[model samples]
Target: MKPGTLRVWSQVHTWSSLASTAFLLILCLTGLPLIFHDEIDALGKAHKIEQWDEAQLVPLDHAVDVALAKRPGEVPIYLSFDEDRPVVNITSGRSADVPEAEMGFQPIDRRGAVAAGGGQTGGVTDFLLDLHKDLLLGQGGMYFIGLVGLLFVAATVSGIVLYAPFARKAGFAKVRRAKAPRIGWLDWHNLVGGVTLAWALVVGLTGTINTLADPITAWWRADALAHLTSGEGGAVQPYRSGLVQKAVANAMAKAPGMRPQFVAFPGSPFSSGDHYAVFLQGATPLTKKLLTPVMVDARTGEVDAIAPMPWYMKGLLLAQPLHFGDYGGLAMKLVWTLLDLAMIWLLGTGLYLWLGRIRKRAR
Candidate 1:
């Protein structure tokens, strides 16, 4: 590369890295615990439900009834199943459009129709997730984080471009420990950064995609489900007979092989005002996160339409698990954790080198 072009790339690499270092550090720190959130969450549980026969499991209506009994005036917003156990988590609030903070979660045991655990809403993991995702600033914070992710990507690409020239003489992964501390740190940063380049790019890009989750969902609802959502009836009332259960069964019948992931009640963000949107998941690991919505009539319990996710929605769904290493099992999570640690080190070393240069210039 020409010296002028090299200088411009160098400046890009330096400024971009500097601009995103703090936010990247926050993400890396919060993300480490998140990679193992499932394991960490399991530690505090006082009750564990044993596996039960499918026939012995209680009806979905019964679980919703029990959950509603706990909060008399609240309406059911969502009903979700546990993948491994005979448990159903019911989310309720004053209305379908209730804020998440005001919602109540009850995990009912399907075998005995009893409350299994209190709730998984507020906790350290949730706090870390909120921080990592949007810095607790909601939609605006997500956009900011997305911009930071872009900066991080810029830094990574520029670093890769500059690496070839730097390593031409020193060779790859060569650390001159006998020289100045900054030189050694710079070499270490480049080596580690190179080793984790692909993984970093993947995570950065996916995370940026994840930041647009709300907008993507909104767009999907407006475009794909416009026909269903534009219906005349008002939101369905909760506990109005056995409509919820029937709608779920109808949804399951429509999609024979898939399992019910969650049910979005009428007037909720995931559903139309008069439809129960039952989100189903496939059996395979890759397809499990990619959900297909089966819209059922909340009032009549009839199958309205099966809405397949659009390409952008599918991309968002796929990006989420890949970003969190949730696609693979424990082994993948461990690998993600190691990469996160290396990223932290890379960011730290880069900051150190940049500060050293500034200090030397000052003198």
Candidate 2:
């Protein structure tokens, strides 16, 4: 690149970082708690069933029935499996994901359901996730952060362009403690940012991709959902959940002892007809994250097809675990968390440097 081009890139890097620093700071702050969300949630009080074995597992529908028996008007909103417990959560509510803002999530177990431990899912962890994903603003907040992520990428590329010239003046680690305040801050910003480049860019890009989840999923449903139709329509109208229930049962019968990772309901652009879209996880490490979904016909409750994920959708699915870093152990989590904090530090110093330069010019 020419000297002029490098200078222009540097200007962009400086201004872009300055423009989004505050929001980015909030993201980093909230992101910290989420890094340890699993660990933190584990610290809480738990209900241990001494005899969950019952010699065998009970039908999930039975558990759902138990939950509904407790909350009459409520419908099953979420049925989450415990990562390390025999507890099954049956959250009942309206079609809208979260129940009313006032009456939050209600967890259910095998024997019965109860309104227990409803003080912000993971306390600080939930706070951070909400703030980071949507800034507690719901969908709008998520998009805004996604846009910030886009700008972050642009700024990262521009920063690298600027780095080439900056390196001409000094070595990679040449931080001068006695330099002018602007120079000192800039050095620190670059120091932290440079080392964290790979992680930051990956996090920013993947996070941005996650932001487009609603749309991407819609697109997938539009295209792939039809794939389930077998060149026919009218099988789904109003999307009865029972159709999905029937379909899931059919798929499970065919899967032969395979466990369900998650299920997509019908009429949801995410699902077709009433047939349930069931994803089965591989029992092996190499294929655990890889899933093959079985499509069941909504009306007939019969198996439609058991197929591999579309290449694009499969890539997206795999990217999720990689981005979150939850696939690995504590050491991996710590590394990701530390890098996240490094991003926070880099953002802080970069903002300080940008402001310092502005004040200098003003003086």
Candidate No. with top lDDT: 1
Model 1 error, position 279 (Å): 0.9
Which segments of model 1 are wrong by more than 4 Å? 44-49, 177-180, 227-239
lDDT of 1: 0.88
TM-score on alpha carbons, each prediction: 0.92, 0.83
Residue range with the least summed lDDT across 10 consecutive positions in model 2: 95-104
Query: lDDT (0-100) at residue 2 of candidate 1?
Result: 97
* Per-residue lDDT of model 1, residues 239-276, tens digit only: 47588778988989999999899999887888888888
